[model samples]
Target chain A: MADEDATDEPQGPRTTTAEIVPLRLPPVADEEPEPLEDPRTGDVDEWGRSERVRALVRKAYDPMYRNWFRAEWDGLDKIPTEGGALLVANHAGAIPSDAPTIMHGVETELERPVYGLADHFFKSAPVVGTLWSRTGGVVAHPDNAYRLLHDQNQLVLVFPEGSKGPGKTYNERYRLRRFGRGGFVEIAMRAGVPIIPIAVVGAEESMPILFKVPSVARALGAPYFPVTANMALGPLGALIHFPAKFKLRVLDPVTFPDVEPDQPRYSRSRIMDESEAIRQQIQEALFDMLRQRRSVWFG
Target chain B: MGRRVLVTGLSTFWGGRVAQALEADPDVDVIIGLDTREPTVKLERTEYVRSDENYSILSRIVKATGVDTIAHTFLVVDSTTMSSRAMHEINVIGTMNLFAAASAAGSTVRKVVVKSAALVYGSSPKDPYWFRETDRRVAPARTRVERSLLEVESYVRDFARDNPHVVLSLLRFCNVVGPDITTPLTRALRLPLVPKVAGYDPRFQLVHEDDVVAALLFAIDREVPGIYNVAGDGQIPWSEVMTIAGKRGIPMPPFGIGLATDPLQRLGLVDFAPEVIDLLKYGRGIDNRAFKDAGFAYEHTSAGAVEAFVQAMRLRDTVGSDEVDYRYEEDVETFFRHSPAVVRDTPPS
Candidate 1:
């Protein structure tokens, strides 16, 4: 019976299949053959980013981007036409509209793909995670960032403040959160990419968090559950953002000449200093943008 | 002067396939296959040696046969196939003994090629888009298969470190799909409605079984002494993979998937193990560039592997179960190999 089972196993089918379809032999060492055509049926790339999905999303969100926020960009040309750059920005609002605004703006203006690096929390959610990935959101892992900036030579947008920026109450809106252990700076240094800081205004007011329900957040295994002013509009408020004039100011690209790329480790103090300087620059830029802004609803 | 090779788990798919490939090479003078059961595949010149799962007599065989290359393909990456304890014995203890024998005093083993799975990099939401060889698992292994594989790899790592002279290469292959191999993913794809985690379309990296065997051969031939991830180029989402296979996905509840699959397992419908469930949720991708850099070319991309598997499935459906012609008869093989009456054309080296 065991012998029968053994005979019934792979050998028979494998040989028969070999007769039908010729076995592909490995190419000789020097002469590499053309790679087998990838039979991918979807547009999703290795990073889970889909141009088709992004285009569809851009189409749906364009009305909100143009009319609702009326997002305006200053010194957009300061971003390089080519090569990799880490676009560091201040994150805010209940859901953080700044990321999409910046990504959509830069993608539309410069015609380059901008990958928004967010917390892995987005990836844990079922439908949300899939949507986030398809629409060009990658987890903010140093390895993922390095590959994006160095190997792929693609523009990456990251919020150094992280969930803290979005988790803050309405009162603590513009105040910058502590930059995450300066890991982003280290990644930029290692990837041999310059850090381009951008200050975003009106995101804090877009969906201002009145308060947070910690118990509910803990129960739901969420980062934070925020009760925003939009909640006053009832259930739909969670998805809706107030029409705040979104103004983005791009600062000069900061490069690290002293530190070498692909180092196992960089100077801790150096990373911290660079991170703090970028934060300060963005903070100052935010205040300047806010000062120039005549009104919240209209710029 | 030719290579004397020892292949573990001869009865298993990988072991039999590898031994068969080794037999075709004129340089491989002696092929001694070790397994508890008779080899499933018929081979011309390979000698089969029945051994316990832990390989108690491996040292004696290694010393007596003077096999220079050991292809360790006995590690169980699929948890659903056997009990946890049995799997532990085969994967962990089997590997421990194999390495012990290879590293024994004055051992003739010069090269060791292990067929490991990409399960070492656990599927998780925290994982990078592509796991490089250097990247450690984002989370601690929860399943028995993963834990056992991890333990086996640690042994391999230690063995490599201790025996610097031995050209030890650990090839971590991703989910493999092809005509001959049967894996959880392939089994699922074969189903009428491929089971998926609801609302999660994870990207999976699949390699062809041929690529896997070729990678093992590549490692053995070149004597590459580093861990390499052997996966097909590119990753395809689960939905896309299903579409390519011409099957619609039947989604299991995202939470409490065990509740749904337990009954299926009871009914012998599908064996959805915990690790496979996690994989269904968040599929894994590993960087195949390292092996490619070492001059090993893959015949199938991830999607190509799926296409090949689907094509083979279609063929099987048309062919009405392949007829098993070559049955392993011990006496016949023995007579052919050792009979003095038989004329010797190409004498054993």
Candidate 2:
């Protein structure tokens, strides 16, 4: 089995020869082929969002969007029809109808897809996750946000308060939660996209959380188990909304001109300041919209 | 003098394919393949050396052969093929010994290309839509395969750090599917009823087997160092994959799925490895742009790979596997490679 002689005898003088053979060759410039056709059987995209599903959802949800919520948008023109922008909204209600209302309104009005960046908690559930993904719900990861905002150049709607905004009691309605350590600001800064603050009214009254049972939430492994005023109707109330009017106002786009995009890290104080400023702008807008409101159901 | 390369796992599908590919490369003069078993594929000039599962004799072989490039393809990513103990031996221990041999004092090896799987990134609901090369797993590995692969990667990282002069490229390939390769996913897809977790349709990123070999060769040909994700362009949902295969899916219960699959596994109905189950739940997507930026072109997308596999399946169903079963005969191979009476094509250098 001493076969080294057979292999090595042909190639003589291994030492000087080793020096001539380069360890790393110059990379061969492969002729780039025309992109192959993706043989996909479904419309689900790389982000799991499906346009066909989104369109179908819009068709079915249009009635509820127009009638039940009566979702109305102000300063919708302020949102750029093209290019990427982070749509920051104040979340409310036990189920938080604002995300869908805002997404449905922007998508229908702008005639563009709007990806709702939600908690990964939605992704953990089986049917809900699949439905959420098909209807344009993306997990609110910084990378996911950056890719959507910068790479794909799509509109992304995120509630800065996360589950905290909706998980609060009915008395805490319209009060904005802390904006999640300003991660959204950092992501927008990294993506170099402007943050468009959207203030919403009547989401608080739609499915108001009377109180939350932490024990039940813990048992169910949920963020919060809410006892909503809508639940007084029946078990179906969990899915039903109280027919509260939804009025949404898209605030001016906030651009971080001073900071460079794609930075490894941003100034902590700068992120906090920018995050607080955006929160305050949305809070004030909500109060302004609420002051002009006649009735929760009527808006 | 041309390149002398050492390929691990000569009998395994990847190792045999890689060795065969290297044999076709005129630049690579000497090809030595190491595995516990004999080479499974036909080769002309490559030399196969039998070694134990842990490759304890790798250092001696490395020194004797003076191989400059080592293509480590032996790491077992499929846990169903062996026991956890054997997998640990092959993946973790074998990798440790191989790296040890390569990075030894006065070692001739300068470049190392590791064929790693994207399973190192454990699939979880919290995972980003796309995992960059630098992204860590959202959760720790739960299965033996993932854990073992992770361990092998750590050794690769350490070897790279210790031997900075050695150009090391770690190619993390996503779920590979094509006409030839038989992975857990492919096996499941080939079943009469493709098993899926109930109410969960996760998107999967797939690469064709040809692209996988091409990526490995590309890494060897170029000086592209660092971790590069080797996958096709886009992701396809599991349901769409079954649809492309022209097969219906049978949903496995979402809860206690491991317990549910045990009986089927014993009955040879389905081979749902624990890692694959997690993959079927919250599928993985790796960022393949880094490899593309490194100038490797992929021939198939996620869906295209499935299409290729399905097309092959259709043909196989009609013709019943046209592959000629070639067995390795040591005496015949030795005579062809070493016998003095045999006429040489290249005139002995």
Candidate 3:
């Protein structure tokens, strides 16, 4: 029996070749054209269930935590119902409470399980880390991202401006930062999905940072502490939070073509082009909205 | 095989000067000059191609000439001199035509050198310290001619990249002066009386025509391609130019016109052509570190150019000739009318 096992293992050593010959694979036939939907999408009503969770969460928290803050939404209905989607929003708050609001809005309003990025929050904390990893709260890795979208039919949200938006304090609020060359466009194209640009007004003002307490933030591994409203002086730090009326404005979803039938799924150029188009549309919309917005201060 | 070199707009005053410089270089085997009118400066080897508009001639001339290096020196301070369509057609489309021609011809061309102006820096009290190749143009330019230079510069750079071998060199010059320059500054410096003191005393830098000639020639000789500030070393107050003219036996400009008339003209109290207005208000200057680094040696100064022009005017008996034809006023009129928007607020990418 041992001799038979040895015979099955092959008795010769592998030989190395001096001349490298390029090998080509035989083409495979196209069988399944579309990707399989996640079981989550099947059992949970993606459009309705996600929003229900958001409403429940927001209702539970807002009165106690955000009495002064309001969520303003634009073009909320244009979110695509079936396929994978991309949501790009401006990042503002230091801790980036805006991401949570955005996630909540999409899940509650659009009714989809929204996966987004968290800087340090998900990276630490063992249980929350496991939850994030399972639920597809990507730590901003664009590659693992492809896998998440392909495997999960999930709505991926990105703050393309990254640190630029969130790091801006109250003194410099609402000023749009430079958009990085459109990578989100490429992702949508790869996933054969559409992009929904969500612009949130009043987020910048809510956490109005009077000045950056850089030493405190850096020591704590955070970007900066924005001294907002009553948070400047002693004792009243927790109670000084101001109620700034907030509005989250979502623009129309921008769609891109799927990877070409015979072409590779990941085409960088196609992705960049799609991203640029979406970015331009969002920028124009935001600029126009800002111009027409009646409420400057959330009052 | 010998290479073909195209020089467009070789009929204008500075263009004629450049054509003469190109004639001196033996490496330039075949020459093609594209101009609306036949070139007044005749070259034995140059093939003169006449088109009513620059756009019509660009592609065909490039194809026929098989030009590998296109040296552009087209100047039209006013777009209205040409039809509005013609202004864009000549300046923007004409450049695109060249780019298209280069792309279409698929020649072994290695470089394209375009002469742009430093005026695109706009009026600055010197926060830029010196306008580097990347310094943003701050002020909004008044005329279309000022604005088109930026557009043309960008388009040319993009075009050059389309053909990797076709690299671009943008030479931003600050008032090129040579023996041949009949510009109002040269002419004004040569005038007797009132010219003794240059009005406003703005720090000015001028590139000698010889230096400009050498720079253009170097663009062909060397393969180095990038934007550069081209000017002489001496930053002279306009007064120095008048001083040099004075020593050369030219009469100083009438002092009255600068103090009274210049201010009145600028203030709209007195009537003056746009050219005269431009001349009176020409403040701000460029930093020439890049030109110096590029190994350009200026053989003349703004003062020297003034001396040369004064000498020429004297030789032609045009200085103090009693009849100030004021054809420059017409030139200014034509420039405003024909030139496209000159300065763009956005910095070049």
Candidate 4:
């Protein structure tokens, strides 16, 4: 409306569409000005998840996931392409390589990162904790998970069976342990995210535990010192894997009622039932996969 | 109404600077500085009072000056000049005397801000990477000074609870580095051979002297209850700190440090406090979200803090000549140009 004051204009309202041009600027001193610090630095966030570190970790372990474990998977589409979700899987083996395998498979398949919530033990162990955090591992806590899911909208990977699954004896392999009074279910319910049950088959067999030494475990401040038949061979010999092919089955996502983190609509007993039902699904899937599999060394 | 502020420990740089800065503020009605020794720095409005560890004298000063705010920075960090026994008495007992005086002052002394170190958290294998205020502090009797500071904090806490009307804030600061603030870490990392723990390279989240003063001034202005961690952002490894200070690290074994620390302190080469070993082995830091929530922004980052100390060392190297000091300015610029979390501060042309 103020353009009428501009006498230089040819006309008030008559004009052809003006051609849009890309922004052009005069050449300046130091074009492409470098950042003050290295771009590779400060990649880690407050939660200690570093995309750069995660990328590097994935690069180092991709071969192991593919060739070493022969990890194969299905139903990644069950996870929402957007928004947060919980990937509740079974934990197994003395050294839990299952976290990495499941994380790698889901990350590569979904083309999105899934943060693994590690125990406080991993958060306290000097170099290990720092490295763990950099590699997209958050210290497992209700507040952390709540923030990751509700506030940050991140897909999180959790092993509800916890240390109980891995600390099991050789005979207890593939049997899903109690899911720690069902905290993961409550987390899922509170965060308002669907729970995708993940059943990993090859982990328990990959590093099979022949037996364990509880006294040694207690001395080392570990849950149990698993003395596998392969481990008895020696340090480097223990590293030699049996090449048990990992077949991952991701069941359909189970939705829960939306609630605030501190809201008490969901009781302890109901959450436990839901957790048990989810655990049963993964356990049954493991049995079915075992029925289909012809050999332990091969898929 | 204007703020009547009293600054304790005028002998210390932190106390003197805070006194002077508060004196400069037009909103401040009066500034009263108290210390055992005379202040090295000149002040404008602050009245310097030479006072001993007498509760009655401190209480009289508070009431006479009508001081509502007390900034306590006299927590003896460097005790090379004084005997260890004297330093303990001055730090612990003096603090108790001040608290007693302030308690006697009652609502007249509305606020008391105490300067505590991050060392209260202690360096341990079990410590969280970023310590929160709720995390358990170190048990008593870790080091002589640390134990004293711990006791002092408990006393302050008790005082705060007892006096509901009074506002008490405890600042847990990490290692502070700048031209003015001279700590043992800065002296060790000065030049040539930087003494360090053999196998450990702890990460230090250093705060700039400017940031420390700013935080103090901010607390003086606001009423933020409870304890808050104060430090500039980002952490630099101790090895990197030595490297940035232009020194080659001399890794000392634990036993060697234990043996030589006494002689080193005696020679005044460095203030080798007892807690230095644990600090060198395992670092201490805290998550400073509380400060952020209180609406304060830091001017310098951790990298800048270390860089400022290094620049000061360079300045000290060429103390007599302004031309030589100017030559060292570019080195600081170049050093900060590549440092993470450093802000580029260009002078107004």
Candidate 5:
């Protein structure tokens, strides 16, 4: 009786019965006989940049960038709308959450992908290692930076302070560390790209470290192990953080023409001069933002 | 009277194909295929000579034919498949004999072309991204095949000095893959599962068997003055290669691999040597720009070569181990017979 009723009810085309269509991926390039070029496809680029993993990470961190922090980015226009560029900034906090934010900020605004170069230690960590590479974080080295800026025409972000800035305690917050030996200037000069200084405020308050345990740091093979106020409260302490509003200010970009840094005319003083100029610009931006802010917690 | 050419080791696959390639060419020439054993493939229009390179045998052939070009394709890297004595005689002594004959014949032998392996670079953590011909050929002292090839290269280099009239050329091939290839590497990749170093993902450069023949033919037609490292440029990490080969890669620690593969090796299930394990960790890469500058183009990259091998594997339920059986430490029958009796009703005879 049920079969006869079903047959009697369905007099129309069988298309209506299709609740879910079988997913079909179109054959790669029509199955034609054209040869395949060595293309950077799927998840990763030739330099190990992964779009899929970057997208997944962006989705996971959207809440932090959008709601809890309420981050506001200013001077987006200072970043070139096209071509290669470098965004040099001061890094802070145990976890460099600002790195990803700055990266996503510029990339999303320009509708282009940006690369972040971090310390080699990050690549040795378990889960963060994979996440770092997939989200376009390269192991910080001259060759890696050269390849990104020059060969790939990428917007690479570098923290000249190395690991010192991010591991700073709350007492030393907002104090700029020494930029290492003007490497970024040489890179920008060679790549023929401009360097845009970025000043990120309230990043130091994200994960305030009261003290560090050397023994724990040694055991975990980490550079420094921080005992934050929240971490001191115990395991559940990490579940919540004191929300600090983030204000990002981009300084004017400075550029040097594409020239070899080794020439006798392009002495070490000239490169250092370029580096110091950019450093001063970032320091001014930080002080300006600090003065304008009424409260650190409210931005 | 014409530009006579003689190809040694006609019994081998590379030798057979090279001879066939020369036989079809319209360039004024005569083709002579010389070997002791019968060829593995049919040699059309190639005059086969059944003789060893012993004493006066090869010298007489070189003299009587007045063969100006000699293509030596007998270099072997996988030594596990053959008897130790046979391998040394063919790879070491046979080369000495051929060079002696050519050296004695002097200017009559116009050219000596060797098909060599790029294993001379040796897999190392310190190796460059791509090895140029000018880079040092630094193989470990214990690596016998590579050490022996170095010996042959020295001889070839000396022969070039002694017999300067002969245009000597060397082609060092990277890993080779194709449908007709039956080497230890290809056979290992054909396995259902392969082991990789847990954290080490080394890049691989595989030249197709056809590209190897094509380069050999170019050496035959023109006099390439120096050594050339021949490999397709489609370099990628082994993990990606495993993805392409459709094989499940089990990541094992470098030392832990011994515990897993030792029993398999002892049982003759897996033929990967210790050096091969290192290859999986720090694979080899060779620069083929010199060949490109010489007006030769490769039709298959490393990826294309691997894809062809995978396609051939899909066509057959399983790849046969007939020609590749010699690549192990023990005989097939001995391996099956020693297999704990419970697993074997009848050992393969």
Candidate 6:
């Protein structure tokens, strides 16, 4: 292996295993630092620094990068303590910002941290791409979801309303986006966890979506919002961050009975119907709480 | 010329007083009071039993005292908003036990007169028509207690139909008020700013104890069977009743006190039970034309009953205070249950 790298940057020859072997090790100071804790288990003694550095970078982007938009949480106690949780909240706000707010809610009120499924755009930016890997925020794919929850014992938070959530016009603010698919319910059923209904009141007003940009979507190779309509021509997106008081009421957890880990998962249709019911319950509770002006805002 | 009579539920307000009155009568040779409780009041010719073995007790009493005739004024009212199962145990099962025991004894038990509430006349406020024995069966409004009352009525009717020999008399009473009364009426009277909800316009006709007692005696004398409306002869509005109570120095509260907790009086919990809410929302102010036509005379008017209650309050020094007087504490429990079936069976600690 040492004899293979006769020159730097290997002349126009097919790469051999020996040539690549020398490039693997680096000076101690140049190496990326170890993660303070594992993203999955938070264990330090097992994994290498490169893996830890990736996790650290992801962790750093969460608060700072996400804080670029205003968010709030209320009644975070509804998250369960030990088992995997399926958090179903109303999806609104451009780029579906309620996800981070929900993560913060569970993390702050509950001792456990939540793993959010970020859209494909976060990975499109190289810096954001690295951050996603280290922080454990995946590509928000449907197939990887069930495995993430069932195996990891982490709280799975999803808007369920998808892209239609944040793109809802101002007239539809506070009204929830339609829950198109029910895969979240199936994941919860398979994992045998309680579905926690969360009502996010302030997200819609944060970065209101006026219109979708098909051109920007093509350029970025993403199907969802290219630029928040509030940000399209400018100042409105900044104005939208008016520190709106947000109330998140964690409703009583709805648990599906008799689903064992070894048993077959629930059908997509049944899960979808159950999820819609859970969402409706949250919406009704939110309307009642908000109409009563009984929000428990942090600020 | 001696008349023998057997009475069950004599520890109840109506039955207890009736038992006391019957035992005092010189013409009544044997007065056997069958109760689930040990008979506390003593009478010269009266024997008491604390068990519901009505037939066995009646047979034993008749064998001892040569009782030739039996008359019962057994009544059980569901005063709490418990589950139907609990209500059935106390009201249905308990009544069934009494009736079974009485039947097995083959004593001269001839007639059983029950005291029932006129609230069964359908708790609807618009019950402007006078309720008769033949009136349609009013579906029990939502309160579990009211439903329980209806269940008790059903049992009585069913038992009466099954036993052709045993005569059954049902005395349906309206708001029976007297001084020292802790009824829902009295409680509402004490509320400050009580709401007369749009649909709940209570035109209450409160019966006096004297009149109610008179009606019971009337039933005993005539051996009246079937149902009869027994109450005072006035259609007094709930507001007017409150005014009368206020004039008598009873606090006419302007609002409902039971919706929130009243610290000094834990009694509100019992008063505001869901059953009572059903009674409040829909109970009709009953007509007492049946008893009146049966030659049953009412000595005390509705106003007189209110006056007597206020006077009793003054005598007990509970005229204005909401606190329970030690002497009347047992009465409150008896009055709340409206049943000798409850108090007679349990020993007072």
Score every model by TM-score.
0.95, 0.95, 0.44, 0.77, 0.65, 0.43
lDDT of 1 by residue, B1-349 (tens): 5678999999999998888887776667899999998888988889999999899899999999988889999889888898889999999999999999999997888889999989999988889989999999998998889999999999999999999878889999999999989998889998888999888989889999998887887776764789999999998899999999999999888898887777988787767788888888888989988888777778889999999999999999999668575678989999999999989797533
Please, what are the lDDT tens digits per residue for candidate 2 over residues B229-309? 999898889999999999999988888998877798878775668899899999999999888877767778889989999
TM-score of chain B of 2: 0.97
Candidate 6 local lDDT, A1-299, one digit each (tens): 54323321212212222222121211122343333211122221110113354445447535543454334455566677877777788877765556656665566457465666655555334344434433445446544455456655667777777777776776677776667677777767777677888887777666676666777767766655534545654765533443445667788888878666545555666777787898788779868866865542332
Per-residue lDDT for B227-247 in model 3, tens only?
A: 888776544545455555553
List CA RMSD, all candidates. 6.2, 4.4, 25.4, 13.2, 16.9, 33.4
lDDT of each: 0.88, 0.88, 0.57, 0.73, 0.72, 0.56
- Measured against the true chain A, the candidates' chain A TM-scores are 0.90, 0.90, 0.68, 0.83, 0.81, 0.68
What is the alpha-carbon interface RMSD for each candidate? Answer: 9.7, 7.9, 33.9, 17.4, 23.7, 50.4
As for model 2, its CA RMSD to the true structure in angstroms is: 4.4
For residue A260, model 2's alpha carbon misses the true position, in angstroms, by 0.9
Q: lDDT of model 3 at residue B107?
A: 50
Please tell me which model should have the higher TM-score, number 2 or number 4: 2
Cα deviation of A55, candidate 2, in Å: 1.0
Displacement of residue A178 (Cα, Å) in model 2 is 0.5
Candidate 1, chain B, TM-score (2 decimals): 0.97
Q: Candidate 4: where are CA atoms >4 Å away? A: A1-53, A79-86, A111-114, A119-134, A141-156, A181-196, A252-256, A262-278, B53-56, B76-88, B105-107, B125-128, B135-147, B191-204, B234-285, B314-349
Q: What digit string (tens of lDDT, one per residue) describes model 4 on residues B102-165?
A: 8883337878899888877877544555677777753345677777677888888899999877
Evaluated on the second chain alone, the candidates' TM-scores are 0.97, 0.97, 0.74, 0.86, 0.85, 0.73
lDDT against true structure, model 2 = 0.88
Model 1 global lDDT (CA atoms, 0 to 1): 0.88
